[model samples]
Target chain A: MTTHDLEYDNPNAIEAHNMSVYYGSFRAVKDVSLAIEKNRITALIGPSGCGKSTVLRSFNRMNDLVPSARVEGQVLFHGENIYAPGVDPVNVRRRIGMVFQKPNPFPKSIYENVIYGPRINGWKLSRREMDELVERSLRGAALWDEVKDKLNQNGLSLSGGQQQRLCIARALAVEPEVILMDEPCSALDPISTLKIEELMFELRQHYTIIIVTHNMQQASRASDYTAFFLMDSDRTGQLVEYGSTSQIFQNPKDERTEQYISGQFG
Target chain B: MAVTELRRQPSLLRAAFERFIQVLLVFAAAISILTTAGIVFSLVFETIAFFSEVSIVEFLTETEWTPLFSIKKYGIWPLVTATVLTSAIAMMVAVPLGLIAAIFLSEFASDNIRRTVKPLLEILAGIPTVVYGYFALTTITPFLKNFIPTLSIFNSLSAGLVMGVMLIPFVASLSEDALSAVPNSLREAAYGLGSTRFEVAVRVITPAAISGIVASIVLAFSRAIGETMIVAIAAGQNPRLTFDPTVPVMTMTSYIVQVSLGDTPYGSLSYYTLYAVGFTLFIFTFILNIFSYWMVRKFREVYD
Candidate 1:
């Protein structure tokens, strides 16, 4: 479906209704409900351990990796329930790609990393077609010119920023409709962060993007919408406010959002 | 600044104690190095003495190995060929079974199942090689002779098969560690792309850890070649060059045992032959160990 239709119908690429994440007896995220818009960079901004990453991971069931983790809620993607029984998590992941905070490039050449997804999914293209796809994906991540000549070089040989971008390229090569980035530029330098921010802007044109970040400036600079999540006195995160970037930064509906934005508290 | 602190010059006693500890550590390391060097030197010295009496060309090229015979013909080929044939059979049995066990332990088995199965498998390794030798001689050989009429009571087949079982744990444990060292992220990435678990393990994980797997195989092969007790007890002490498993054969270790147990004079060329055999076995294992280590390091995945 088109982004316009998604906006008119739901204004969200994904919606979590009354979501709660628990690690055994400990509740990490409590009663969090938020809607992320399609074709817009929706930044989940919060301090560390505020359950922002947990909620982001729940989108593609990445939290399932932790044996103790348990989730209760409806995570809707393209108006379909992702957490429903019989809905294959692998298929869900194929449609929704993830870029981790730290650059976790596969121990392989750049060309191999980018084409890994397509190759696994049985994309039987000729060598020329595969090469073209690799170039296109790298260009989409704004990493083409820098690595065009070094496709055969190891992915680990790239600089921190370049590796993160290569990871993004790897994710994009699978042709996912949504991309989930967890602090994509936190480990990078300022110049690399700016490059990533610019790439995020470009990415939103094609893919629905949801990013979790601790950098408020990055939320303001890169995101069209901002979600402010906060932990209460019990250290359980709950959604405080989510709205257009202008409204959240200019005049938040919640006082906590204002306090956080004004640097009164984190 | 107001109070003047009085400090003794660096205590000679403390300095001496620290030096003592350093000396102890250096001595410990030196002992290990020296032990290996001494063994090699002794083996080489005795082997060279034996070769003086028995020409090097005769030892390597002669096909018949009858050192204790009236004619005293000495050929190394029979012993070398027997060792290779037995080792080959042992590896053939060990490699596939060990790899499957490793896959099951690392990939398929549940935590509870692994906890129970791993130690049990290790028990096989812990059984003294002599016990395996006796079992192979009394039980396995008798059982095999019933099925295959041509099987000798003291055949290499039964001994090699039992030796393979003994070596399984080494191969399995090392391979399991190698497989487990593969990052979960790679597996997750593969799964995220719709690859099956089998596909992820076989195609990605195995290739990624190819070096470790190769090293484990080399180590298992070395273990097979150096194995002694089982072959000595079950396989006949006949150093005849033959590829037939149903026939009796002798490995290098078995030949040394046979010569040592016999009434050969200590200073005779026959007695020194033990050192020559020992030196050959030592060099073989040493080269394999070095190659395996190199392979493991060369393919190691260095993560930032």
Candidate 2:
């Protein structure tokens, strides 16, 4: 009954199978399933509080930090159930990184911020190796040139967009297989948002990217395919449409999808 | 309406009333400054008088502190050493336990458990210091005496331990506030990087909250150094020149109290010694406060 029920071929990076997320007793995200293709950008576009962020967080088991949050079904990564017993959420997160809505750089030096993940994972590197990793990660996020001279400066001292990129660089240092961005550019200016969009396209060659955004234009422009989420009768997020960006934006199968894409109602 | 309001000048009475309110507020703010100035002036004046009789060199370098007894050796080291020893012990107890308790309360405990437990922890700080003094004197010293044969009835160990107990809730409560003030986004970033709970709390959150935590510890240490009741009740009256916590030792506060309780003639050298010691205590605590301020100013990483 839901678009989330649709299936994809093999070689998918992440697969949420009949997953439902609940906050306390309320079903915040209804029974919905979706397959995220490998090395492709999948944008979850929806209105405010449509559970896009919630469903995205469930993939890496970040929702486990919430005491009352419970997942009813499975989130599979590379054919292994992430939510299954004895599968550590910490290990799950090691394979899948996340970026937040706002620019949340740790109040540390730029150099320290990038190395924090690698250090905790017990990767002992030489001074030269560390410098290279920092450079590579910063370059990966397209932030190396702006911040090369002062690696010792606080990460929070950067501009809003640069801080977000530093967060992206920090995530990249961990070298996760999939990167989940929860409205990464919502707080950014248009130019910075474009920069992040461009960076996403570049990042798609290496990591599987899943982003939740409210901007219709951003979804169509930045993603290869988009999943449109809307509230159901019970006010829980239900997938209404799923297709390629050009197909959903140009021609829609459902009236609701048409109304949403045409800017009638979000 | 804006032009009319801008064009009009205040009436004489209204202007005078505003001036009066401003002066009143300024006077209210100046009360603290005036009090500090008064205390400083009085302490310095008497400390100079005490120096007239007892040399500054002897006060700093001499090991004896028998101003009340027959020997009358005026070295200030015994009192200073005793105060430092007790405060060090207090810090040793308060730092690890209080910080762990804070981390537990902020990062580990659930909402229900936190709601039920944090208030109970704070209640420990609310208990009067006099009761702690008695608890140290009547109960703790006796319990400790069973283990250590050389433990005196009035020893620094019991007093310092009880002082640490009293300061536990202080350090824990303040540090919990600092640790929790770290934005959840930072924790998320760490978690997203595959950091375990312990790693996130220790490596990420602790470093972020370091300034505030150090501030709490320094403030608690200042409180410990200035504490009187527990030291006076349990840590004996004689100022001795040894680092041994088992033996009875006197602190600067205890000396001041001992002198103030008995009859010391006004305008005498004995009376001036009180101010001298009080001034020394004041200087130590002032340095600690300044250090705390500098640490917070220099190292604080502001997260918005």
Q: Which digits, one per residue and each the tens of the lDDT, describe model 2 over residues A91-183?
A: 989989999999898889999999999999999899999999999999999999999999999998999999999999999998998999999
DockQ of each: 0.47, 0.79
Estimate the TM-score for candidate 2.
0.94
Q: Candidate 2: list runs displaced more than 4 Å.
A: A1-9, B1-23
The RMSD (Cα, Å) of candidate 2 is 3.6
Model 2, chain B: what is the TM-score?
A: 0.96
By summed lDDT, which 10 consecutive residues of candidate 1 chain A come out lowest? A3-12
How accurate locally is residue A260 in candidate 2, as Cα lDDT from 0 to 100?
Answer: 87
* Tens digits of per-residue lDDT for model 2, B1-304: 9999999999999999999999999999999999999999999999999999999998988888877777777888899989998888888889889999999999999889889888998888889889999999999999998999899999999999999989998899999999999999989999999999999999999999999999999999999999999899999987998889999999999999999998999987788889999999999999999999999999898776
Q: Estimate each model's TM-score.
A: 0.92, 0.94
Best by TM-score: 2
Query: Any idea what lDDT model 2 has?
Result: 0.92
Candidate 1 to native Cα RMSD, angstroms: 2.8
Best by lDDT: 2
* Weakest ten-residue segment in model 1 chain B by summed lDDT: B1-10
lDDT of 1 at A42: 94
